[model samples]
Target: MNKRSLIYSGTLIFLFMVAFLIFTEQKKESPSGVVNISVQEAKGMVEKGDVFVLDVRTPDEFNSSHIKGATLIPVSNASGSNLSSNRLLEARIDEVPKKKILVYCRSGRRSVSASTMLVNAGYSEVYNMAGGINAWIDAGYPVVSSEDKETDGSQN
Candidate 1:
Protein backbone atom coordinates (compact mmCIF):
# COMPACT_ATOMS: atom_id res chain seq x y z
CA MET A 1 0.00 0.00 0.00
CA ASN A 2 1.07 3.64 -0.58
CA LYS A 3 2.53 5.62 2.37
CA ARG A 4 -0.44 8.01 2.55
CA SER A 5 -2.99 5.19 2.41
CA LEU A 6 -1.16 3.19 5.08
CA ILE A 7 -1.01 6.20 7.39
CA TYR A 8 -4.75 6.88 6.96
CA SER A 9 -5.63 3.26 7.74
CA GLY A 10 -3.40 3.30 10.83
CA THR A 11 -5.08 6.46 12.07
CA LEU A 12 -8.55 4.96 11.60
CA ILE A 13 -7.56 1.81 13.51
CA PHE A 14 -6.10 3.89 16.36
CA LEU A 15 -9.25 6.02 16.58
CA PHE A 16 -11.45 2.93 16.64
CA MET A 17 -9.41 1.41 19.46
CA VAL A 18 -9.66 4.61 21.46
CA ALA A 19 -13.41 4.71 21.02
CA PHE A 20 -13.73 1.05 21.99
CA LEU A 21 -11.74 1.60 25.17
CA ILE A 22 -13.83 4.57 26.16
CA PHE A 23 -17.05 2.64 25.62
CA THR A 24 -15.83 -0.29 27.71
CA GLU A 25 -14.62 1.98 30.50
CA GLN A 26 -17.98 3.70 30.61
CA LYS A 27 -19.74 0.35 30.63
CA LYS A 28 -17.87 -0.69 33.77
CA GLU A 29 -19.40 2.30 35.52
CA SER A 30 -22.77 1.43 34.03
CA PRO A 31 -24.02 -0.03 37.34
CA SER A 32 -22.68 3.01 39.17
CA GLY A 33 -24.64 3.01 42.46
CA VAL A 34 -26.46 -0.26 41.90
CA VAL A 35 -25.59 -3.12 44.23
CA ASN A 36 -25.60 -6.87 43.59
CA ILE A 37 -26.72 -9.33 46.26
CA SER A 38 -27.37 -13.03 46.66
CA VAL A 39 -30.89 -14.44 46.49
CA GLN A 40 -30.72 -15.51 50.11
CA GLU A 41 -29.86 -12.01 51.23
CA ALA A 42 -32.66 -10.59 49.15
CA LYS A 43 -35.12 -12.92 50.85
CA GLY A 44 -33.95 -11.87 54.28
CA MET A 45 -34.09 -8.19 53.42
CA VAL A 46 -37.56 -8.54 51.97
CA GLU A 47 -38.81 -10.50 54.94
CA LYS A 48 -37.28 -8.00 57.35
CA GLY A 49 -39.14 -5.21 55.59
CA ASP A 50 -35.95 -3.38 54.73
CA VAL A 51 -36.29 -3.82 50.97
CA PHE A 52 -38.97 -4.03 48.34
CA VAL A 53 -38.94 -6.68 45.62
CA LEU A 54 -39.30 -5.81 41.95
CA ASP A 55 -39.89 -8.32 39.18
CA VAL A 56 -38.48 -7.04 35.87
CA ARG A 57 -39.35 -10.06 33.80
CA THR A 58 -42.07 -10.17 31.19
CA PRO A 59 -45.75 -10.53 32.14
CA ASP A 60 -45.84 -14.15 31.02
CA GLU A 61 -42.93 -15.13 33.21
CA PHE A 62 -44.40 -13.25 36.13
CA ASN A 63 -47.75 -14.94 35.61
CA SER A 64 -46.15 -18.33 35.88
CA SER A 65 -44.37 -17.57 39.16
CA HIS A 66 -42.53 -14.86 41.09
CA ILE A 67 -41.42 -13.91 44.55
CA LYS A 68 -44.31 -13.35 46.87
CA GLY A 69 -45.14 -9.66 47.24
CA ALA A 70 -42.85 -8.51 44.42
CA THR A 71 -44.07 -5.55 42.44
CA LEU A 72 -44.37 -6.11 38.73
CA ILE A 73 -42.63 -3.51 36.64
CA PRO A 74 -42.25 -5.32 33.36
CA VAL A 75 -39.42 -4.46 30.96
CA SER A 76 -39.75 -5.57 27.39
CA ASN A 77 -36.75 -6.87 25.39
CA ALA A 78 -34.48 -7.13 28.43
CA SER A 79 -31.49 -9.51 28.41
CA GLY A 80 -27.97 -9.94 29.74
CA SER A 81 -26.26 -8.03 26.91
CA ASN A 82 -28.86 -5.33 26.27
CA LEU A 83 -30.55 -3.35 29.05
CA SER A 84 -33.53 -1.88 27.27
CA SER A 85 -35.73 0.85 28.70
CA ASN A 86 -38.88 -0.06 30.59
CA ARG A 87 -41.77 2.36 30.26
CA LEU A 88 -43.56 0.84 33.25
CA LEU A 89 -40.63 1.39 35.56
CA GLU A 90 -40.22 4.96 34.34
CA ALA A 91 -43.87 5.82 34.66
CA ARG A 92 -44.47 4.17 38.03
CA ILE A 93 -41.15 4.77 39.72
CA ASP A 94 -42.82 7.17 42.09
CA GLU A 95 -44.97 4.39 43.46
CA VAL A 96 -41.95 2.41 44.58
CA PRO A 97 -41.14 4.18 47.81
CA LYS A 98 -37.54 5.19 48.38
CA LYS A 99 -36.23 1.97 49.87
CA LYS A 100 -33.83 -0.81 48.98
CA ILE A 101 -35.22 -2.10 45.70
CA LEU A 102 -34.40 -5.75 45.14
CA VAL A 103 -34.79 -6.44 41.43
CA TYR A 104 -34.86 -9.87 39.75
CA CYS A 105 -35.70 -11.54 36.46
CA ARG A 106 -36.20 -15.06 35.15
CA SER A 107 -32.55 -15.98 35.68
CA GLY A 108 -30.89 -12.72 36.70
CA ARG A 109 -30.09 -11.56 33.17
CA ARG A 110 -32.64 -8.72 33.03
CA SER A 111 -32.18 -7.65 36.65
CA VAL A 112 -28.90 -5.99 35.75
CA SER A 113 -30.73 -3.64 33.42
CA ALA A 114 -33.57 -3.05 35.86
CA SER A 115 -31.26 -2.29 38.73
CA THR A 116 -29.22 0.08 36.58
CA MET A 117 -32.34 1.94 35.56
CA LEU A 118 -33.44 2.25 39.18
CA VAL A 119 -30.04 3.52 40.27
CA ASN A 120 -29.89 5.99 37.38
CA ALA A 121 -33.38 7.19 38.26
CA GLY A 122 -31.98 8.41 41.59
CA TYR A 123 -33.02 5.49 43.79
CA SER A 124 -30.15 5.25 46.23
CA GLU A 125 -30.84 1.74 47.52
CA VAL A 126 -31.09 -0.39 44.39
CA TYR A 127 -29.98 -4.02 44.25
CA ASN A 128 -29.85 -6.80 41.66
CA MET A 129 -30.43 -10.44 42.56
CA ALA A 130 -27.36 -12.26 41.23
CA GLY A 131 -29.28 -15.31 40.04
CA GLY A 132 -32.86 -14.02 39.99
CA ILE A 133 -35.75 -16.30 40.90
CA ASN A 134 -33.80 -19.35 39.92
CA ALA A 135 -31.45 -18.75 42.77
CA TRP A 136 -34.29 -18.02 45.12
CA ILE A 137 -36.02 -21.24 44.18
CA ASP A 138 -32.81 -23.17 44.53
CA ALA A 139 -32.48 -21.73 48.00
CA GLY A 140 -35.80 -23.41 48.86
CA TYR A 141 -37.83 -20.24 48.78
CA PRO A 142 -41.47 -20.40 47.77
CA VAL A 143 -42.83 -18.28 44.92
CA VAL A 144 -46.36 -16.98 44.39
CA SER A 145 -48.21 -17.82 41.25
CA SER A 146 -51.03 -15.93 39.51
CA GLU A 147 -53.58 -18.48 40.69
CA ASP A 148 -52.51 -18.03 44.29
CA LYS A 149 -52.45 -14.22 44.45
CA GLU A 150 -55.50 -12.17 45.22
CA THR A 151 -56.73 -9.59 42.73
CA ASP A 152 -55.16 -6.60 44.48
CA GLY A 153 -52.89 -8.31 46.95
CA SER A 154 -49.28 -8.70 46.04
CA GLN A 155 -48.79 -11.87 48.09
CA ASN A 156 -50.68 -15.05 48.80
Candidate 2:
Protein backbone atom coordinates (compact mmCIF):
# COMPACT_ATOMS: atom_id res chain seq x y z
CA MET A 1 0.00 0.00 0.00
CA ASN A 2 1.02 3.62 -0.57
CA LYS A 3 2.34 5.65 2.44
CA ARG A 4 -0.60 8.14 2.29
CA SER A 5 -3.17 5.32 2.24
CA LEU A 6 -1.55 3.66 5.28
CA ILE A 7 -1.58 6.95 7.19
CA TYR A 8 -5.26 7.51 6.39
CA SER A 9 -6.19 4.02 7.63
CA GLY A 10 -4.26 4.53 10.89
CA THR A 11 -6.05 7.84 11.55
CA LEU A 12 -9.48 6.24 11.09
CA ILE A 13 -8.55 3.39 13.43
CA PHE A 14 -7.35 5.82 16.12
CA LEU A 15 -10.57 7.84 15.87
CA PHE A 16 -12.69 4.71 16.23
CA MET A 17 -10.77 3.67 19.37
CA VAL A 18 -11.21 7.10 20.94
CA ALA A 19 -14.96 7.06 20.29
CA PHE A 20 -15.33 3.56 21.70
CA LEU A 21 -13.41 4.51 24.88
CA ILE A 22 -15.59 7.56 25.46
CA PHE A 23 -18.77 5.52 25.13
CA THR A 24 -17.46 2.96 27.63
CA GLU A 25 -16.57 5.64 30.15
CA GLN A 26 -20.07 7.08 29.98
CA LYS A 27 -21.61 3.65 30.53
CA LYS A 28 -19.39 3.05 33.57
CA GLU A 29 -20.35 6.35 35.15
CA SER A 30 -24.04 5.52 34.78
CA PRO A 31 -24.69 1.85 34.18
CA SER A 32 -28.43 1.90 33.52
CA GLY A 33 -28.43 4.68 36.16
CA VAL A 34 -27.97 2.40 39.19
CA VAL A 35 -25.74 3.45 42.10
CA ASN A 36 -24.59 1.41 45.09
CA ILE A 37 -24.54 3.38 48.32
CA SER A 38 -23.82 2.53 51.95
CA VAL A 39 -26.64 2.02 54.43
CA GLN A 40 -25.62 5.13 56.35
CA GLU A 41 -26.04 7.28 53.28
CA ALA A 42 -29.40 5.66 52.57
CA LYS A 43 -30.48 6.40 56.12
CA GLY A 44 -29.59 10.04 55.72
CA MET A 45 -31.61 10.21 52.57
CA VAL A 46 -34.48 8.42 54.23
CA GLU A 47 -34.38 10.81 57.19
CA LYS A 48 -34.60 13.72 54.79
CA GLY A 49 -37.62 12.07 53.08
CA ASP A 50 -35.97 12.75 49.77
CA VAL A 51 -35.83 9.19 48.55
CA PHE A 52 -38.40 6.40 48.25
CA VAL A 53 -37.05 3.39 50.14
CA LEU A 54 -38.06 0.06 48.62
CA ASP A 55 -37.91 -3.10 50.72
CA VAL A 56 -37.58 -6.12 48.44
CA ARG A 57 -37.88 -8.78 51.12
CA THR A 58 -40.75 -11.26 51.43
CA PRO A 59 -44.07 -10.22 52.95
CA ASP A 60 -43.51 -12.37 56.01
CA GLU A 61 -40.02 -11.01 56.50
CA PHE A 62 -41.28 -7.48 56.03
CA ASN A 63 -44.08 -8.08 58.47
CA SER A 64 -41.75 -9.67 60.99
CA SER A 65 -39.29 -6.77 60.74
CA HIS A 66 -38.55 -3.85 58.45
CA ILE A 67 -37.16 -0.37 58.31
CA LYS A 68 -39.63 2.34 59.21
CA GLY A 69 -41.50 3.86 56.27
CA ALA A 70 -40.05 1.54 53.62
CA THR A 71 -42.35 0.45 50.81
CA LEU A 72 -42.58 -3.32 50.40
CA ILE A 73 -42.28 -4.78 46.90
CA PRO A 74 -40.93 -8.27 47.50
CA VAL A 75 -38.77 -9.08 44.50
CA SER A 76 -38.63 -12.82 44.96
CA ASN A 77 -41.07 -15.45 46.16
CA ALA A 78 -40.49 -18.35 48.58
CA SER A 79 -38.54 -20.28 45.92
CA GLY A 80 -35.76 -17.67 45.62
CA SER A 81 -36.85 -16.84 42.09
CA ASN A 82 -38.72 -13.67 41.36
CA LEU A 83 -41.76 -13.30 39.11
CA SER A 84 -41.36 -12.95 35.34
CA SER A 85 -37.60 -13.28 35.38
CA ASN A 86 -37.43 -10.53 38.01
CA ARG A 87 -39.48 -8.13 35.91
CA LEU A 88 -41.92 -7.78 38.79
CA LEU A 89 -40.16 -4.61 39.88
CA GLU A 90 -40.62 -3.23 36.38
CA ALA A 91 -44.36 -3.70 36.58
CA ARG A 92 -44.52 -1.62 39.73
CA ILE A 93 -42.27 1.16 38.51
CA ASP A 94 -45.09 3.68 38.51
CA GLU A 95 -45.58 3.24 42.24
CA VAL A 96 -42.27 4.96 42.92
CA PRO A 97 -43.08 8.63 43.37
CA LYS A 98 -39.63 10.09 43.85
CA LYS A 99 -37.02 10.37 41.15
CA LYS A 100 -34.48 8.74 43.40
CA ILE A 101 -35.27 5.36 44.92
CA LEU A 102 -33.32 3.38 47.52
CA VAL A 103 -33.64 -0.43 47.67
CA TYR A 104 -32.75 -3.01 50.31
CA CYS A 105 -33.41 -6.65 51.25
CA ARG A 106 -32.57 -8.98 54.17
CA SER A 107 -28.99 -8.94 52.96
CA GLY A 108 -27.40 -7.16 49.98
CA ARG A 109 -27.93 -9.80 47.27
CA ARG A 110 -31.54 -9.18 46.32
CA SER A 111 -31.15 -5.44 46.47
CA VAL A 112 -28.61 -5.63 43.63
CA SER A 113 -31.07 -7.62 41.55
CA ALA A 114 -33.86 -5.20 42.38
CA SER A 115 -31.67 -2.25 41.51
CA THR A 116 -30.77 -3.74 38.15
CA MET A 117 -34.44 -4.37 37.47
CA LEU A 118 -35.37 -0.81 38.34
CA VAL A 119 -32.72 0.60 36.02
CA ASN A 120 -33.99 -1.51 33.18
CA ALA A 121 -37.48 -0.28 33.96
CA GLY A 122 -36.35 3.30 33.21
CA TYR A 123 -35.60 4.44 36.73
CA SER A 124 -32.90 7.06 36.34
CA GLU A 125 -31.69 7.03 39.94
CA VAL A 126 -31.70 3.69 41.77
CA TYR A 127 -29.49 3.13 44.81
CA ASN A 128 -28.85 -0.32 46.24
CA MET A 129 -28.23 -0.54 49.98
CA ALA A 130 -24.79 -2.15 50.22
CA GLY A 131 -25.49 -4.33 53.25
CA GLY A 132 -29.30 -4.20 53.15
CA ILE A 133 -31.45 -4.22 56.27
CA ASN A 134 -28.98 -6.51 58.02
CA ALA A 135 -26.34 -3.84 57.69
CA TRP A 136 -28.74 -1.22 58.93
CA ILE A 137 -29.47 -3.30 62.01
CA ASP A 138 -25.75 -3.88 62.54
CA ALA A 139 -25.30 -0.12 62.35
CA GLY A 140 -27.69 0.28 65.30
CA TYR A 141 -30.67 1.48 63.33
CA PRO A 142 -34.20 0.68 64.48
CA VAL A 143 -36.58 -1.69 62.74
CA VAL A 144 -40.24 -2.12 63.63
CA SER A 145 -42.26 -5.30 63.64
CA SER A 146 -45.72 -5.41 62.07
CA GLU A 147 -47.42 -6.01 65.38
CA ASP A 148 -45.63 -3.10 67.00
CA LYS A 149 -46.51 -0.84 64.12
CA GLU A 150 -50.16 -1.80 64.24
CA THR A 151 -50.43 -1.03 67.93
CA ASP A 152 -48.43 2.17 67.74
CA GLY A 153 -51.51 4.05 66.42
CA SER A 154 -49.28 5.55 63.73
CA GLN A 155 -51.19 3.96 60.87
CA ASN A 156 -51.27 6.11 57.81
The root-mean-square deviation over C-alpha atoms between each candidate and the true structure, in angstroms, is 11.1, 9.3
TM-score of 1: 0.67
Instruction: Give the lowest summed-lDDT range of ten residues in model 1.
Output: 147-156
lDDT of 2 at 72: 83
For residues 1-156, could you state the per-residue lDDT of candidate 2 as single tens digits?
999999999999999999999876552323556787887888899899988889887776777778888888877774454456344555666777648898999778888888888888777778888888888888877778776553221221
- Per-candidate TM-scores read 0.67, 0.68
Worst 10 residues of 2 by lDDT: 147-156
Superposed model 2: Cα runs more than 4 Å off: 1-32, 79-88, 148-156
lDDT by candidate, in order shown = 0.75, 0.76
* Residue-level lDDT tens digits of model 1 in 1-156: 999999999999999999999875552233377777788778888889877889988666677788888888875554342434644677667777787788898777778877877787888888888888888877778887867652322221
